[model samples]
Target chain A: EPEVTQTPSHQVTQMGQEVILRCVPISNHLYFYWYRQILGQKVEFLVSFYNNEISEKSEIFDDQFSVERPDGSNFTLKIRSTKLEDSAMYFCASSESISGRARDEQFFGPGTRLTVL
Target chain B: EDQVTQSPEALRLQEGESSSLNCSYTVSGLRGLFWYRQDPGKGPEFLFTLYSAGEEKEKERLKATLTKKESFLHITAPKPEDSATYLCAVQEADSWGKLQFGAGTQVVVTP
Candidate 1:
């Protein structure tokens, strides 16, 4: 089965540095999302992207965060000036459609573990 | 605001044993509920989607059921390989594609 794929399985960056996490969602998927899991914490929604624009974002997705569909197959999340608190596992997900009964299911990638020192 | 709570933070079972995991939610307008499984260092893997109170879906040893305020994931004759963290999430009422997820239950099945 086709699955979402993320690049740079693990990354280490210093505080105040920048990092960009990349994902290639399923080819036919339309809705894309970014979520993060702090060690020992629940998965938290960051942002959703569709039609080359942001559909919705949570408070966690603040000014330092940005997402881009740089190409037809690539969805990227960039965090500027990483902080110690930014250390976490960042996941990328995609869904075929978003409505009605089938809209709730989200297929997630293996995730990129970011470590900020 | 939407909140999802999963019961039994951790569980242990022997191979071939059967058990169920619970997920309860508090949301204004119910859109859909989802179930996923995660390995130690990986992202969540999609399992089932439940839209209505009576909806149920199954695959392999896993079966998922939904209700007005909660959802259950039943594992039948589980194997040691079935050990993982199971997560539950709810889609918000007005949001088009955002997901609110639960903390998840960690299961360890011994052979």
Candidate 2:
């Protein structure tokens, strides 16, 4: 089965440095999303992208965070000036459609573990 | 605000045992309820999606049922391979693709 793929399974970065997490969602998927999981915490939604634009974002997706579909298959999330609290597992997901029943189920990538020191 | 609460944070089951995991959610307008399985350090794997109340779906030994306020994942005759963290998430009707997730229930099946 086709699955979402992410680059750099693990990343180590220093505080105040920038990091870009990349994902290639399932082929033919139309909607993409970014979510994070802090250690021992629930998965939190960051943002959703469709049609080369942001559909919705959470408070956690503040000014420092940005997402881009730099190419047809590459979707990237950039964080400017990472903080210690930013250390978490960032996941990328995609879905085929959002309107039909049960069509919104998303498939997630293996996730990129970001460690900020 | 949407809130998802899962009961019994951890469960230990013997091989061939059967049990259920509960996910209760509060959302403005329910668009869909999803169930995912996650192993340690891995992303969630999609299992089933329940769109409306009274809807149910089954896959292998796993069965998921949805109600107006809660959803349940029943594991029947589970094996050691069934051990994993089961995650439940919700999507609001008015939202695009954002999913609100619960803390998840970790299951351990021993032989």
Candidate 3:
């Protein structure tokens, strides 16, 4: 089966530095998302992207966070200024369809472990 | 705020033993409830989606049931291969397709 793929399985960055997490969602999928899970915490939604635009975002997705679909397959999340709290497992996901109030299940990537020091 | 809480953070079951995991959630205009399985160091693998109260879906030894306030994943006669962390998530009508996930329940099935 086709699956979502993310680059840089793990990353270590200095506080206040910038980092970009890249993902390649399933080729035919339309919607994409980013989520993070702090150690021993629930998975928290960060943002959703569709039609090359942000559809929704959470408080955690503040000024320092940005997402881009630079190409047909590459979706990326950039953190302008990493903080200690930014260290977590960031997952990328995509959905094949969603329309007319129907919900389409999302497929998740293995996730990138971001470590800020 | 949307919230999801799962019960029995961890569980251990002998081969052939059956049990259930619970997920309780609060969200406005719930669009769907989802169940996923995760192995260590891996991302969630989608299992099922429950769209309404009283809805149920099943695959292999797993059965997922949903209600207005909670969801249950029942494992019947499980085997060692069933050992994994089970995650439950919810999508609200206004979330724009973002998922709110619970702290998963880890299950260990010993053969």
User: For residues A3-117, could you state the per-residue lDDT of candidate 1 as single tens digits?
Assistant: 9999999999999999999999999999999999999999999999999999999999999999999999999999999999999999999998878566547899999999999
Tens-digit lDDT track for model 2 on B1-111?
449999889999999999999999998799899999999999999999999899999999999999999999999999999999999999999998889999999999999
B-chain TM-score for every candidate: 0.96, 0.97, 0.97
Interface RMSD of 1: 1.1
lDDT of 2 by residue, A1-117 (tens): 999999889999999999999999998999999999998899999999999999999999999999999989999999999999999999999999988485788999999999999
- The TM-score of candidate 2 is 0.98
Q: Candidate 3, residue B81: CA error in Å?
A: 1.5
Of 1 and 2, the candidate ranking higher by DockQ: 2
All candidates' TM-scores?
0.97, 0.98, 0.95
Model 1's CAPRI class is high
Q: Order the candidates by TM-score, highest first — what do you get? A: 2, 1, 3
Interface root-mean-square deviation (Å) of every model: 1.1, 0.8, 1.6
Better of 1 and 2 by lDDT: 2
Using DockQ as the yardstick, the better of models 1 and 3 is 1
Rounded to one decimal, what is candidate 3's iRMSD?
1.6
Instruction: List candidate 2 segments past 4 Å from native.
Output: none
Place model 3 in a CAPRI quality band: medium
All DockQ scores: 0.82, 0.88, 0.73
Tens digits of lDDT, candidate 3, A19-113: 99999999989999999988777788999999989999999999999999998889999999999999999999999765523448999999999
Clashing pairs in 3: none
Off by over 4 Å in 1: none
